[model samples]
Target: MQRIFITGTAGFIGFHLARLLLDEGFTVAGFDGMTDYYDVRLKQRRHQMLLQSPGFRATEAILEDRDALDGAIDAFAPDVIIHLAAQAGVRYSLENPRAYIDANVVGSFNVMEAARRQGVAHLMMASTSSVYGAETAMPYVETQKADTQMTIYAATKKATESMGHAYAHLYDLPTTMFRFFTVYGPWGRPDMALYKFVDAILDGRPIDIYNHGEMYRDFTYVGDLVRGIRLLMDAVPVRPADPADIAPGDSLSPVAPHRVVNIGNSTSVRLLDFVEAIEEVLGVKAQRNLMAMQPGDVPATWADASLLQSLTGYRPQTDLRDGVQRFVDWYRAYKDSGGLR
Candidate 1:
């Protein structure tokens, strides 16, 4: 059986990815900090579910805790390593910039070190479309100027892409960094837009609408997001034979086995339409407290996912309404399970 070592297994994306791996008969070794950035109970619940699968084994440690992570990887001896843990959130980074450095910057460096030491077949990690920064580009392609990052979180993620590339060059580690665009669905992070909107709408509270409801996002469902990741696990890059063949904005290190791919729905939906999806599911109109754009926030993010299809023959296909309804169903069940007191 192929073995996979994944970080952030307790987080939303990690939990989903780990479950998918387990079902596919891959023996998964999971590591997670289980930070109380959101609800510890939710993270715990996700972990609880994964434990029921016999092939899944978990070790807990902070990614920045290099020594602990090293020990865990040594024990797991995985064929592949997926680094998904990071201090996530653009606004949160502004509130606590040091957290980004500790978790994202130092943390990712630790993951790269582990992957290099293990000499894994491939190392994959999650990046955000926020790295696109303030580019007025309509659809973000793999080969585009991403040097301009607006938020500390985006900057750190962009930094990791560079760091991963460097590691790939130095150690010949095959690496793929996926830039995800607004991933959403059931079991999503509570701090994300969909969850917060669902909770507020259900509780009859006002939901914050950024950019005065003028924002646009390539809202990809979590299942499609995970499938794209699974396909990418096998799309490892070979170091380029010639630097001149590297396309523009490809984020390919001429000397390394590294490339960046955009995994998104490839369709940008208006913010009001997303809110309407939630309202439609809940049968209630949100008390929209429309406001100005927040600092370090972008007005729109769209992905050019043709590269993902070309590489993996996959594209994220979940529609907003269907995805939102699934989330609502999960939310109701989660509440019924005594999530809310």
Candidate 2:
């Protein structure tokens, strides 16, 4: 079995990815900060479950601590290094910009440096659709300019893409950055839309409908998101000879063995319709407290995932209703157990 070093194994996406890898017979060395960014018990539960598999080993440490992080990477000597740990929330970033800088920016540097030293075959990191802020084009493509980031969280994630490029250029380390588009599903984060909506609807509380219920998102499920990452791990980019030869809409750098691909459902789901799906699953109606869009939030986001399909031969196929139902099932079980809300 191949050894994989995954940062943030305790996080939402990381938890799902680590479980998938372990089930596939890969030995995973999980590094997590176990930060209070969310419920630490939930993170602990994720780790606890993973520990049941003999192939999984976990290390608890913050990504910003370069020395400890480097030690863990060297100790594990993984075949691939996946950096998914970060201060993950668009709204939270507005309240605490420093967290993004510390976690997303500085923390990413430590992961890349370790990957460079270990000479890992593949290095994959998380980018976000928020990086595509303010782009009016339908179906945000991989080749679009992502400089106009609306939130500090997005700006930092976009920075990691650049950071990975420079390292790949310098060391020829194969790197792929995946931009997520509103990922939602089982084992999802509490701060995400699906979780919040589910909680409010089930509790008979009013759900906050941002953008006054006019927003649209390309809601990709967590299972689909992790599968895309797994496929991309094997689809590492090779440095091209001429920058001009780079394919149109390709986020590949001219002189680096690095590329950025959007991982999302190609279809966009409106916020109100998304709420309806949750209600259907819970068999309850939500009291909508419609509100204007928040600062640094865009009205909509959609992804053109053809590049992902061409490279991975797969696309996120889970329908919105099905995904929402799966999430509700998980949520209800957790609520019943008093383990999740």
Candidate 3:
């Protein structure tokens, strides 16, 4: 069994990914900051569940604390390091721009440094589709020029991608950077749209519909997203001797063993349709509060996941209504069991 060290195991996607890896009989070491960004209790619940697996152990520390992070990584001596911990939120970046810089920029540098020092076989980091900012192209592809980032959040993530490429070139570190779309499922963040909408609707509060219900997102299920990550673990990129030998539509860097892949459902669902799916699941009508587009908000985001499929022979195709129903069920059960109390 390979030893895998993962950061942010207390987070939404991290929790799910850790659980999946544990089930596959991998020895896993998890690190998390357990910040009170939303609710520490929810984060605790995620880690608590993972602890049930005897193959799992975790360290609680922020990524900004380089000593702690390095200690945990050094102790694990992992074959692979999946860097998932970061200050994550698009809207919140506007309120605390420095937080994004501290965690996403400086903290990411620490992880890269550790990976290079450890000589890990592979280093995987999470990026976001928001990096494709100001590009009007439909179905965002990895080969497209992603220059015009609109928000601090997107800019920081883009910076990490560039940094990862540089490290891959200089250190010969095999690296994969994933650009994830709107990921949702059970045990999701309270700040996300599906979670907030379900909670507000259940409480009989009006739900905010930004852009007057004119938004679209490539809502990738958490399960599908993590499976993509797992498969890509084996598809490590190798530096191409000749740039012309590279396959078409692949984002692999010619000068480095690094690549960027977008993990998404490949379909853009309208925001209104998503809300209606939630309403149908709950059998409750949402008191809709239409609002103008918030700053740093995009009207639509769709992913071209062909490269992901070609690389891994898999694609994320979970149905929106089915995924929404799963989340609703989990939400009801969690609330009944005294969640958020």
Candidate 4:
């Protein structure tokens, strides 16, 4: 069995990805900061569940701790390193911009250096759809120019993409950066929309509808998002001998063994419609709090997932209502189990 070392295994997407990989019989080593950014108990619970699998082992440490990160990766000697740990939260970036720099920028650099030294076959990192800031283009494609970054969070993620490209070019590292669209599902982060909306509604509180409920998002289910990551792990990018040889619409770097793929549902659901779906799932109406768009917030995000489908032969097709139902079920169970406390 192949060994995979994953960062942020206690995180939302990372936890789901680790569980999936563990189920597939891969020997997995996980590293996490277990930050108090949200409820530490939720993260701890995720780690506790993963530990049920004998093939899974984990180290609790922050990504910014280079020595700890390097030690864990070296001890595991994984064939692949998936870097998913980063200071994640767009609006929170406004309150704590320096945290984004510390984790997303400096921490990402450490992961790249470790991957280079280990000569891992693949080094995959997570970027975000937020990086497509100020670009009004519908169905954002990977090949398009992504220069405008509205917040420090997006800027840091964009910085990591550029950094990954440079490392791939200079050291011949096989690197892939996946841009995730508003990922939501079971075991989702409390900071994300679905979780907050569900939590507030269940507690009889008003749910904030930003942009006056006119916003849109390509709400990619967490399961589909992680499946894309797993498939891309095998579709390793190769530096093309000629730039002309690259396929049309492909985002493969012509000068390096690197690629950036957008993993999303390819459908932009209106914010109001998403809330309605949640209400339907819970059989309760939400106290809607209409408000102006927050700073650094985009009105919409839609992904062009053709490149992901071409590489993986799969696309995220989960229906909004069905996904919402799944999350509602998990949220109810978790809340009943005193997870919300």
Tens digits of lDDT, candidate 2, 1-341? 28899999988899999989888888899999999988899998888888888999999999899889999999999999999999989999989999999999999999999998889999999999999888898899988777899999999999999899899999999999999999999888898888988888778899999888999999999999999998888888999988889877677888899999999999988899998888888889999999988999999999999999988899998999999989888888987888833
Model 4 ranges off by over 4 Å: none
lDDT of 4 by residue, 1-341 (tens): 29999999999999999999999889999999999999899999999999999999999999899999999999999999999999999999999999999999999999999999999999999999999999998899999989999999999999999999999999999999999999999999999999999999989999999999999999999999999999999999999999999999999999999999999999999999999999988889999999999999999999999999999999999998899889988988998989842
Clash pairs detected, candidate 1: 143-249, 143-250, 144-249
Q: What's the lDDT for all of these models? A: 0.91, 0.90, 0.95, 0.95
Q: Candidates 1 and 4: which is better by lDDT?
A: 4
Give one digit per residue, the lDDT tens place, for model 3 in 1-341. 29999999999999999999999999999999998889999999999999989999999999899999999999999999999998999999999999999999999999999999999999999999999988989899999999988899999999999999999999999999999999999999999999999999999999999999999999999999999999999999899999999999999999999999999999999999999999999999999999999999989999999999999999998899999999988999999999841
lDDT score for residue 241 of model 3: 94
lDDT of 1 at 262: 94
Model 1 residue runs over 4 Å out of place are 244-251
Q: Single out the weakest 10-residue window by summed lDDT for candidate 1.
A: 245-254
Worst 10 residues of 2 by lDDT: 332-341
* TM-score head-to-head 1 vs 3, winner: 3
